[model samples]
Target: MDSLPNLLWLRSFEAASRLGSFTAAGVELGLTQAAVSGHISALETRLGHALFHRTTRKVDLTESGRAYLPAVRKALQDLAKSTENLFGGKISGAVTLRAPISVATLVIAPALAAFLESQPELNIRLLSAIWADTALETNIDFEIRLGAGQWPGCQAEKLGDDFVVPVCSPFLAKGLKTPADLLKLPRAHILGFDDHWPRFFETLALPVHSPTPSVTVDTSIAALEWVSSGGGAALLLERAARPLAASGRIAIPFKEKIPLGQGHYLIHRQNAPPSRPAVRVTENWLRELFGS
Candidate 1:
């Protein structure tokens, strides 16, 4: 017998040892039970030792098999990962992306057509959250965030500055000529948790205390819809509200704009390698959209 055992035989033995049955290993490997049993027997004979104690009902690994299990399992895992990496797994396979709901709806959704056109082979899965709630170590490939430039232990790229301004329907814009005129109208506030309206009011010189809004919403998109429906005036990001603004659904209430404190950014774990398809799609599309 040759000193070196067959790789296929070792694979069969490892699967049988972990599953505790040749029949189960056969199911997993897509082989017949007899084939699996023969492979394990061949491995044991080549090594001059019995790897498992087989009975009519079940199989148990011998002491030598137990000692060898960990190394074999780790080797197999490493080989599998390497094979996937070699076969464009990181680029063509599933890519999970996380982003804020507003950004995902307005920015990413509009730009996705171009991305899909360029890289048809890649599959993208998008996850939207109200806040930065995604666990980066999980299956997520990347995260797009709206914040000041400071994400620790991650590779960050600033997308664009998020600017906010008061937006109202054309019907509501009729009497709203000055900043003081805003006090007479009902204002829509996004309530669950964002400082957009508060920060916007701070930019004006007038002593305008935030009114207990007539309509309170949980999302920027919802607030935009309310404004479009002629419910009330809402303060929304210029980028997110641009589409509606262009369509004449909503109008900017004031000539002066307010800074919303931060910009949109794309982030990924520093230790993790970036997915090639994700990087290519994001960079090219955002550059075209934002002219950055």
Candidate 2:
């Protein structure tokens, strides 16, 4: 096409098509019904085809309108997204990253400050999920999840290895000498993970005959709390247990760390709605800090 239709005209066409009336489109666009009709008429003159079929009670999309609506809608969407990405409200940036509680609290929380310091304009929001291994969430800017680094409509990068290691209070930890010693204690199963205790036993060739849990909890944080009270031994992610072990609140009685096979992945849903530069900077910081 040599000449493009005016945006106001295209807007009128799209609004009228969507709402099924020029009067309603005019109401929406703050124009009179005649103005909406005039826009469509001018557009029809330019395009050499009528976009709407009109009657006394209603208006309907013509065959040409049906064909053209999708492109026009997509073009409008692209323009809006481009405007938001390039020049929208990011003077003082805001980014929301969602991750598992253990990873968020233990792994990233300690190091997140330095990242913010480096990029002084950002306000970072960390949303904690107990079961963070599932699907991509809408409106989440970044995700740190424990999984196989795969999801639809996303970019998943390997953050690092995660291993399941048994942890308990210092007093209880001192009493254990062998893998067999663990079998006698009550086991607090972290519910979201694989059957870690059974796998942990089998990894050491210590047979478990119908292994049962003393307690079950959804989050590693809860399991850690239970173990710290000397309630039972809980198998926890190595990253989750690392800080507490350093503080002497919990102890890793055995040297063996069972590979989880899956691990924490830094995931970004690529351009579903494109991210701003600050969020992109935070994404890079997370990858650099956590990625293997």
Candidate 3:
């Protein structure tokens, strides 16, 4: 029993069983279909057990194979990830970070250059998508999330509050003098936040009505773009809209703003301890940036 089957054969068998196609496994493993088949056959011969039920169209894992597949797949993946961590290069590895597209583009992307300069060896892979509850578990090292500051099963740090105010293009601000004047100008809405308009109206002591908008966007950044392009006024976070305000593209119409909770947080999985570099860099940078 000292002479075990090749590790490559186990990898090929695991991939084939998981993917349900030798050809697909070959594509993933960078081997030919014949080579993958040979590896699986070799593993089966060594183990004296058929691992898969092969048919004309597909392959299904046998009971023994199903039992063995998870451990094999996890081992291989852990090996690959650990190898990347160990000898990848320059005492640096990639940090997979996730954030909303608006925050990523407006806030984080601008500050990234300075961070990169500070840590010349490290690499960052940024992912921007819709806010999801399960983001920390999805192969991401860190996530910048905007919500009510109540995320469970994650280590959380408050980034800042999201102060939302009505803003429009500098050109559109000509006739808009007060909150009452806002009723005349075309408005823009961000979907899934139906209370944004209502909250603003309530703050201004106006009755809630079905407000018509010139444009509706799924993301806040897009709404800002519309406002900047002279499309209409938008309710946007002060942190994100400040740059455009500085550039003379947009102007906040009202002095009174609605506090939309602590808008952003940096979160990571609670179960897994962050790597040394990840924790150090993230914690220091956030403290410097947000004064936390």
Best by lDDT: 2
Give the worst 10-residue stretch by lDDT in candidate 1: 271-280
Estimate the overall C-alpha local distance difference test score of candidate 3.
Answer: 0.76
Report lDDT (CA) for all predictions: 0.74, 0.81, 0.76
User: Cα miss at 256, model 1 (Å)?
Assistant: 1.7
TM-score of 1: 0.61
Which sections of candidate 3 miss by over 4 Å? 1-92, 207-212
Off by over 4 Å in 1: 1-93, 151-153, 191-194, 198-202, 287-292
| Candidate 2 residue-wise lDDT, 135-185, digit = tens | 577767778888787777778888777787889899998888887889989
Tell me how far the alpha carbon of residue 259 in candidate 3 is from the true structure, in angstroms, after superposition.
Answer: 0.6
User: What's the best-to-worst order under lDDT?
Assistant: 2, 3, 1
After superposition on all C-alphas, the RMSD of every candidate to the true structure, in Å, is: 9.3, 7.0, 8.5
Q: Local error of candidate 1 at 217, Å? A: 2.2
Residues 179-242 of candidate 3: C-alpha lDDT, one tens digit per residue: 8777777788886555477778887898655566768888887888888888877888777677
Poorest stretch of ten by lDDT in candidate 2: 269-278
Candidate 1 lDDT score at position 109: 83
Candidate 3: deviation at residue 186, Å? 1.5
For model 1 the local lDDT of residue 125 reads 82
TM-score of 2: 0.65
Model 3 TM-score relative to the real fold: 0.63
